[model samples]
Target: METGTLYIIGTPIGNLEDITPRAIRILNEVDVVFCEDTRVTRRLFERHGITTHLKSLNARTESLKIAEVLDLLKEGQSVAYVSDAGTPTVSDPGSQLVGSVRNEGIKIEVIPGPSALTAALSITGVPASEFLFLGFLPHKKGRQTQLKEIAQTKRTVVLYESTHRIIKLLNELEEHIGERKVCIARELTKIYEEVLCGTPLELRGILENDPQKQKGEFVVVISQ
Candidate 1:
């Protein structure tokens, strides 16, 4: 039997309507859907009224499950891989599975959709002719090293930061980059979506005064 194809589907980051028609069709037609979190994907599926079978495929068990997924493909079962949000393998997981499937000589296709990084960059009006996406900074060890590396980059830099460490990261950036222009995109595509632009020091003061502004995931953009 001919090997089945692997579809890397991209889902919406926040707003459900952001999903494209092609993505919904593929989701409904695929024999099985592999996602980082089945529970999260289930919400999307339920919202769209899609009832396709879903299997959990994340960094934790990707190695153990790749063989099984490959086996299913060998049996001519079409499968789709999706992350909890946005495109799969963009700091989410599933790169190993894609590599292993390609090694097996099976076909793979990417179905692009909403990405928080691109969405944040586009709306921020920050020049992104050349930019670096440092997915998530190290939590402890080498954290300073990572910040220093970002500081040296001549082009714009984008990073994903959690609510807990955003203030600390801003302080570090201010210290190393010295009042560089910065943009913070928080709760993107949702009801509370906010885009704040200012120097690192300025943003720090504003966030410090309004503690509520510090809540939710943050996308930090720094201009060189």
Candidate 2:
């Protein structure tokens, strides 16, 4: 019997139209789909008219359910793994499962699609020949240490910030990197999508004055 293949699919970050046709076909072709949030992924599948059943798989539940994935793969079942948004395994839950499948010599295919990191970078106009990508800062512990590091790094820096912490993150960026040019992108590919360019202090004021601007996923790009 042929060994089953594991598909690492990249779903849209915001707009459902961002998903590639190949990604859509694979999601439908796979025997099962595992994602970060079924409710969120369901919207994407529903938008594309895909009826594949979704199973919950995230950072918290990865360990508990990875064995189940392995068992299915060993049984020659083609499986697909996706994140709540963007590509899988970039600050998502597919790292362990991908590695596990690779160690067992199972086939793995990456279905390239949307990525927030690349989306923000494309619109930032910041020189990113090479840049440091810090996915998300630690909420409390060592947060300052990371900020300090960001202050000194010569390369461009990219970081993801949530709506709730955007203000706090901007304050830290201002405190540490003072006057460094920063580009903030929110709601990529969505109706309210916006890209703001200014110093952290300046952008913070903009977000504060307009409550609507501070209400989505954010990608912060710092110039060298």
Candidate 3:
């Protein structure tokens, strides 16, 4: 019997319209859809009228669930994996699952969709021929070291940050990079989409003054 295929589907980060036609077809046809959050995926499914079976696959229980997924694939059940938003395995938990399936000789396919990092970079007017995606920085032990590395990188650096910690990370960048040009993209592709560009210190002041602006996820782009 042939092994099943694993589809890494990328859902919209903010707006539902960002999903492609092919992605919608795959989501509806797949045997099962594994998502980080069932409720969140349910909303997307409901909007598209897709009634495919849903399963929870997140970092917390990925290890325990991998065996079950592998078994299903071995039985020739096709599966589609999607993160709560954006692409999976890009700061998401689908990497291990994908790797495990591949190691078992199962096929894997990526269904690319809206990504905050790529979307923000495209509109920032910044050169992205060479770039580094740092995802979310470490919170504690190696946080300073990671920031230092980002500061020294020659290529453009992109990072994902929570609204709550954006100010703190900006302060750290100001101290480490010192006057580097930065772009902060928030609520990307959504109704409140915003892109603020300036020196680290300048952006810091803007964010501080408008507390309401810091209510959504952020993508920080730093130019070398």
Ranking by lDDT: 2, 1, 3
Q: Using Cα atoms with residue i matched to residue i, what is each candidate's TM-score against the true structure?
A: 0.97, 0.98, 0.98
Q: Indicate the residue-level lDDT of 187 in model 1.
A: 91
The residue pairs found clashing in candidate 3 are none
Which model, 1 or 3, shows the larger TM-score?
3
lDDT of 2 by residue, 1-224 (tens): 78889999999898889989999999999999999999999999889999988899999999888899999999999999999999988977889989989999999999999999999999989998899999899998988888999999999999999999999999999989999999999999999999999999999999999999999999999999
All candidates in order of TM-score, best leading = 3, 2, 1
lDDT of 1 by residue, 104-219 (tens): 99999888999999999999999998999998998989989988888798999999999998899889988999878999999999889999989888999999999989999899
Q: Per-prediction RMSD in angstroms?
A: 1.0, 0.9, 0.9
In candidate 3, stretches whose alpha carbon ends up further than 4 angstroms from where it belongs are: none
List lDDT for all candidates, in order.
Answer: 0.92, 0.93, 0.92
Q: Could you give me the TM-score of model 2 versus the true structure?
A: 0.98
